[model samples]
Target: MLVLVFGYLFGGAMTVPGGGDYREFLLPGMFAMTMLFGLESTVLAVTADTARGVTDRFRSLPIASSAVLGGRAVADVIDSTLRLVVVLLCGLVVGWRWHDGLGAAAAAVALLLLLRFAFIWVGVYLGLLLKTPESAAMVQILVWPVGFLSNAFVAPETMPAPLALIAEWNPMSATAAAARERFGNPGWGEQSWAAQHAVAMAVGWPVLLSAVFIPLSLRRYRHLSR
Candidate 1:
């Protein structure tokens, strides 16, 4: 919520030729950014369990091995959804209206949940791979760069040409773009192949990430238990 508020304040500060309402333009990105931040909780919880040997205890239990990870994933998604709702309500209080009707808003929420689901798998993989809270803590620093490099806070065109190219292709950029378009934010770049591809990539990424990581993480868990 602080991040979203700060982003609105920062957006309000910028001077541009075709100036737009910063609050309106920024709210969708803030929504996406909030979900991006939620991955930290997943990482922390998983790493903590590993560090305390709670995961090992689960491994030795009579329950199916998948239950341990599956339960965590289910719980994380519920928690993330609640957080998104609270942040959206905060956006509403700050003059961020949803110009796009109910359908678009619903789709936007679905996309956010999809992103969270994908990141859960990432958290699982990281938790299983690192096996120690300190190791995971060191690697988790990359989330900031990944979050900042995309269109979450500013227009990708505002970045240097080389960096702009990379930001343009970033997955979070696609998610932000799609959310902005759905939310009716102004000053978005010209609709190009990138914009068109963003929708597909945004949806496809979570599915692909989950497919690859869930099995890999489960396999790793099984091996560690033996």
Candidate 2:
């Protein structure tokens, strides 16, 4: 939570002229960042347990094998919810408001939670695949570049042509664009397609990612115990 709060504050400070009222732009990105951070930590913890032979002990117990991974995912979701509350409170303190009213705000939060759920499954798959703390730590380094390359801190158009193209297609960019519209931010572009497509892509990616990773993680978990 501190990282996200300070991250938004620092990001807001860097973007002059908009810094005073940039929460509309910064809030969604911070939410995404918080989710990603939580996902990475959950993955790391699970991988560490596997590496330390804790998972072996759990496998020997009479408790259902699914309980191990399921419990971690559930606990991570609860933790993510708490982190989101903190981030939202900080946003309120910094003058963030949802102009599209409670419904839209709730939808935005729901989408964020969905994204976190998707990532949790992805983390589970990765944790089981690598089965080591070192490999999981190495995988986490990719998060920085992925987060930065998206429209988290700047408009995609402001980026160079090639990079802008990549940013536009990024799920984070789509999520942020949808969030900006929900917040009633001005100058969100005249074309409706960008926003429409962004909303679709943002929601779709998480669904697809979850569908793919969750089963894979479950299979890998079963295999590991055999």
Candidate 3:
């Protein structure tokens, strides 16, 4: 909420050349940013469980192995959804609107949650690999830079060619672009192929990230007792 308020206060004043309203562009990106921020919570939760030996205790229980991770995934999704709702309501209060109507808007939200879900798997893998809440604290330093380097705060076109290319290809940028288009918000009128087909990338990136991390997380979990 504070981030959103601060983003609106500062970012809403800026506009991409030939783009629509800055606030319109800012909101969808903020939504994507908020979802990405869930990475921190998931990382901390998994790390804390490991650091405190809660995971070892869980493994010793008679419960299904999948239940432990499944429960964490479910809980994270619910928590992320609640956070998204709060952001959405705050967005409305600050004059943000979805011009794409109900179905598209719903799809945009589903994409945000999907992004959150994939990041949980990444967090799970990282937390177990680090094996310490102290090392997991470093994830914060990495996450914020990745978040800011995308289109969440400014148009990629405003960046230099190299930086712009990186931003354009960023997974978060794909999702943010897709959400903005879904919500009928402003875009930087990117001419590149990636920018033109953002929704596909938005969906594909999360699936790819999850496919990579889920098996790794599961394998890591199974090997933890070794």
User: Which candidate number would show the highest TM-score if scored against the true structure?
Assistant: 3
lDDT score, candidate 2, position 182:
60
Error of 1 at 160 (Å): 2.4
Q: Model 3: per-residue lDDT, tens digit, 1-226?
A: 7766765676567766685677778888989988888898888899899989999999888977578888998999999999999889888887788998999999999998888899888888888888888888899887887798898877788888888888898889999999988888888888888899999999999999999998898889989967
TM-score of 3: 0.94
lDDT of 2 by residue, 1-226 (tens): 5645665567455442333345566677777777766767877878988999988888888877668888988988998999888888888776667788888888878777877888888888888878888888776676777788887676767779898778777766677666666656432352335545776877988899888988898788878966
Ranking by lDDT: 3, 1, 2
In terms of lDDT, model 2 sits at 0.74
- The C-alpha lDDT values of all candidates are 0.77, 0.74, 0.86
Instruction: State every prediction's TM-score relative to the real structure.
Output: 0.89, 0.84, 0.94
- RMSD in angstroms, candidate 3? 1.6
**In candidate 1, which residue ranges exceed 4 Å CA deviation?**
7-19
| Cα lDDT tens digits for candidate 1, 80-143 | 9998899888888777777779898788788878888888888887777777777776544867
**How does residue 164 of candidate 3 score in lDDT?**
87
